[model samples]
Target: MPRTTGIRALIRPLRQALRRRISRWITRCCGTPHPRTGPLPAPGRILVCQSNSRLGNTLLLIPLLQGLADRYPHARIDVVIKGCVHGSLLQSLPGIGHVHELPARGAAPRAMLKLIRELRRLHYDLAVEANSLSTTNRILLAGCGASHRLGFAGPDQCLRLTHAVALPSVASHSALQLLHLLTALPGRAPASQPTLAVYPDAPTRARAETRLRRALGSIPANRPVIGFFTRATGNKQLPNAWWQQWRAALHAGGDPPLLIEIVPPGGLPVHADQAAVSTTDLMELAALLARLDVFVSADCGPMHLAAAAGIPVVGLFRATPASRFAPLGNDCISLDEPLHPVVVARETVWRYDRRRDTRRSA
Candidate 1:
């Protein structure tokens, strides 16, 4: 397992040295990037480098995208995303012009070089390094060759973050940190309320609902459907027995909510007393999640996706800290075990007004 803190500390000096080298090379390759010194004009073309390859990271970036769309309503935003599957993740998001799908981190040298050439072919008014703690992200920000570059300043990262904002004094989630980076611009302020968001179009919603109805058999007017995602990465994965225990407790509370398995990536439909739905299409999954009354899962991408879909979520936090990646929005809460299942059931039923928990009291 990668101990992130230890790795980051070990690589810090190497990162600094590489930054200096890249700084000099960028000046020669793309010419000197202009400093953000004068009255700012609205940028027409913007590039953001946040190539961290995780479904959760991709979803968490929505707030920053929301901020850019709001602040520069007319500008075009491009995201350089790593990983093959994630390239299309944000392609359809409003105000996004393009998604530059870079190969996964540590791709072939030729592919990386080709991507650099392609990026250098265009001119961007602004570029952003959206991560606070990534040497690769910073190097890509420099390579983008935008007229003005922005980032969160870490110790001695002046070469890349010519226009940088100091990280917030108080600790915050990674999503919030990215949003704060936008505030460094002149006459700019971060969104008052930042939430992860995904917009599923009408056809997509219709298709999702159709599939859901097939599984649900009958859509009752007064029932609460609770979603459960059974798998997570590494130690975050919860065993089937644990879920059985939770559900049993809920049943003991009487009028148990309908439990549906919301399968995660690389997971099969759980063979249990529940309906299961799985799809490769994220938006379709989001739409299906949206129709549900509430969602429950270990801290994972689908948990974030459910929050983006505007559903109430109960996120399980055992291996990961909920402080950074907990579902943010209305009626969302993060909990650590050993969660008293009876208490959880009671609270969920009460909050959702699940008097014997029906399919959403119409």
Candidate 2:
């Protein structure tokens, strides 16, 4: 029985390999073909697949989904999300149609096959695999029975996609590049800037405002709500001396500081009258964020969330290239600097960033 189990495991891997090899051979020989629906008729249905690695990555996908809908207004756009929670996020986000829950990970062979069968029954006109091309993604796209498959590919992986967008350098923001792929297709070119829309309930907004009021009691509201996100990769937080200097600067300028932190239900180092909240719940976070006039954060998920919410953001970026992570909005500011022999001030924020050229007019 033990030997039989071992043999069975080996057979499964071998079978997968053989299937992959066959799929590749077919793609290389015949070349991946576009949808054969005769002409440029409107697609019946479209599926956008999610296999992104991070929260910011997933958030960036919003515009691409919007662009797809804009281009194919008649088509029912469905998103295959990686989890039930992920599907819920997509459902809450604007510009989404149907949200199909995918496994928390990649679909198993049997599961994938079943999904393909279900998709076939729906008669999808196109499937856009919006992830890095792997043997699995290639197989999934080829096997899904969609007439068209689109993806970004390099010189080596070009053949696997029916229509491949030229993958840009890693320095470029993946979100912007993804938008290009949608626009560069056979339809109308995409808009100049992609935007995300969110509508927070009034009560939630009020609650968030009440919390902020308690945190910054008697502080002038117009004094540039300079939020400090004191966490980053490997403790890029502001030291006591830095805070001391910050306090000195603010006091000299008649401004007050409002320190934000995660508290119970998420993380806690609770203190009195502090505007603490959880990051785990989007609704709670959204409420807290809606109350902020301006937000400052590290190059983390919260930063992207703030940008998506159309809030003015200032991001302190280190290690990662700011190009890929910077919030591309007029109100958002990205400051790229190494955590060093510390020099931090309002001036320091502007000095470190090349993008901060358009100074706030006096």
Candidate 3:
């Protein structure tokens, strides 16, 4: 097993290098030649690359998308996302006019060729590598041949693009780092709040509610819905079990209030009085989160999704520091492990009350 593991590890770096090279070559081939004598042209069409695998990881790109939308409000924002995340993920964002799905989960050469052809046809004006600073994602963005290719400069980063942002120190959130790609542009500020537009239609809302009800029988709408996501065996796990406990206690302390959504190891089970939505699809998860009043999840993608949907997110952070990955919203709440239960309950109540007041004000 160790030998196989070592081989697998070795293969990844090698595969990444090859993918990065292919990405660089594709970008160079697709690049448009404009004279260096003038300033960059205004964005006519922009491609935001978010081909990352994990759902939570891709959600990190929301800030970049929002920032771009804010700066070039009129620019058509196109996202190049993996098929699993495309439909459910980018559809809700404010500026995302189109999402070009990259069919690359399986079948390498054919998929790569198809993606390259599709990009060639689009001929985007600017390409922002809003994904990870890894060699692969950077190279993929570089290959898009946008007039302005933006990414970070790592020590051995080979995918040479014209515009680049310096990688933030380890202390910065990965979401914030993705926004650095925007800093390379003029008249753009990185301080803008991250926004994700989740406008679920009546039909979608009904379907989601129906599914939740079917799974968790008869939940009271009057009760505050506290979501617990503990499937963190992999990348999806959050370390806020203690917070969930505190939330349960707080609810017990409340009057007729506290329905928890339990998503666990064997998948979401059928239960009464709560909603359970279990899917690997990032977009569906985001939509479900939009319906939630508050979500308590690990420091993973769903936490950000819940936060982006404007729901209050109580993100429990573990080995990965909460400082870097806290949900990016006023309503989003985060708690560190080993924290006092009173603090957790107080913060949850405060945010919940604040959300209620905001709705009342609105």
Instruction: Per model, state how many residue pairs clash.
Output: 7, 0, 7
Predicted candidate 3 versus true structure: per-residue lDDT over 1-362, tens digit per residue = 13456678889889989876765565456432221222457797888877676666677777788788888888899887775544566667777788877666566767776676777688888887665444445645656667777666554345556666667777977777777767777774676455445555666667776766666567764455556565654533534555455655676664634445556435653333344556554445566677666776667666776777678887776667886788887567667766665666667667666766666788
Better of 1 and 3 by TM-score: 1
Best by lDDT: 1
CA lDDT of each candidate? Answer: 0.76, 0.60, 0.65
**Best TM-score among the predictions, by candidate number:** 1
- Per residue, candidate 1 scores C-alpha lDDT tens digits across 235-282 of 887787777777777677556667788775566666655788778888
Give all TM-scores, in the order shown: 0.85, 0.73, 0.78
Report lDDT (Cα) of residue 150, candidate 1: 82
What alpha-carbon RMSD in Å does predicted model 2 have with respect to the real structure?
6.8
- For model 1, state the Cα shift of residue 122 in Å: 2.3
